[model samples]
Target: MTRFQSPFVRVCWYLSLAILAVPFVFPFLWMLSGAVKSQTEIFAPTLTLLPETWHWENYAEVFSYQPFARQYFNSLYIACVVTAGTLFISSLAGYALARIRFAGSGLLLLLLISALMMPEEVTIIPNFFLMKWLGLMNTHMPLILLPMFGSQGVMATFLMRQYFTALPPELEEAARMDGLSRFGIFWKVALPLSRPALAAVGIITFLFSWNLFLEPLVFLSDIELFTLPLALSNFTDAYGLPLWHLQMAATSLAVVPILVVYIAAQRQIVESFALSGVKG
Candidate 1:
């Protein structure tokens, strides 16, 4: 319908999509194929796209080893708790940043934005020592608390702030006239309108917490308390080579659900990240 449009332009667009899709789709396809394959076939440079036999037992063995089910539950519940905590705390902080024109608000926002640029690796040493001194090591406390207060949390805060910045201040002022406290305006008025941003923060925070390995490995030592990512890496034999089948199966289990969610909500999910990234 446009004079500038042509068949060649359409071809180029489709080609670009196929190229972009390969890295995402290929890895998952290969992982699925690899997960089903017998041990001998795992490392083939030329991919084994499919195997003659499907070994569903890999999933079972993954659970049979080292209370995998419990580890999974640990990761799931912790992620949920952390996600909810972040949404509340971040939104509270973000709303204040966006709405309140306090004296040091600019400075506070600068510090928070600066934090987003800092890697967790730099603070891990200090955090690890703090956990050890507090006797919180080898527990889920570090896993939940560190991320809830760390860079990921800062990013979520910024996300909510950016969204709140764009909201009409009239609603907040009107609510205040109706006897709504500052907290009530945030919780009842602004937050309800911030579901998209909150959802984004929740999803990203949950995934980051769920897949977090370095913090868990550094802080948690108790086998019962290990998160899924930590548990995934622990699949090893006497020589320390990976137990391919169990690892693949667990990886598949860990990754597949997230991938499904990502695919199902690709638009919202991607938009959330974009909003967060730009704001953060």
Candidate 2:
């Protein structure tokens, strides 16, 4: 008779959740199954979930077809660097915007918000020109600098600012009384307590940079400079037909690490959003 033991309610809830999860979960399942399947089996009429023969060599072919291992390294390192840089810069900017009352602070924050409304596509050409002018064309510097200073980073800054603004003023006031300078307080007190916001920002920024395709496509021409997304696309035949087997294998490799990391830190990621919501 208890609500927890209501069979009708439980069934409906479980069924609804299962239905909702299908779209999100099915694509990954398909991707995984496709990764190990032969090209023929992949496009076959039967639409099987498991491969008839698991092409384990598809993985090896992923490496041999191009500088895929190198490409993997490129994506991983770029994502890591972008994540770290975004965290530092956003946290600093966020803390200042949340606490400081200097003239033009409002205008600066407004400008940053306006920057968010501008799509990346609109500015890609200008960005390309800027990068070319700065001698950063065909380099990882554009990848690192663009995302670290673009809408994503600005969004991270706003998230941190909201979290910091919600924090108790007494905490920083006490630190100030103890002769803690602004930088010292930010480094020692504010940053330590802003873990949830930082975690959320880092996770999102890393994933964004990892899956970025267009920026890399435009900025990099060297095969060795290609990231995972670009490298995955390089698996094609002489006639420009996609080599699905190898492409799927490389795609799976590119996605698996990020999937593992997200699953591992899923709890923290959820908590980060909850914390941000409370602050907002």
Clashing pairs in 1: none
Instruction: State the lDDT at 237 in candidate 1.
Output: 85
Worst 10 residues of 1 by lDDT: 271-280
Q: Model 2 segments beyond 4 Å from truth?
A: 2-5, 271-280
The C-alpha lDDT values of all candidates are 0.85, 0.90
Q: How far does residue 168 in candidate 2 sit from its true spot (Å)? A: 0.7
Which candidate comes out best when scored by lDDT?
2
Candidate 2 TM-score to native: 0.95
The local distance difference test score of model 2 is 0.90
Best-performing candidate as measured by TM-score: 2
lDDT of 1 by residue, 16-105 (tens): 999999998997777777677778777656656887678888888888888888999999999899999998899999999999889989
Candidate 1 segments exceeding 4 Å error: 1-12, 44-47, 276-280
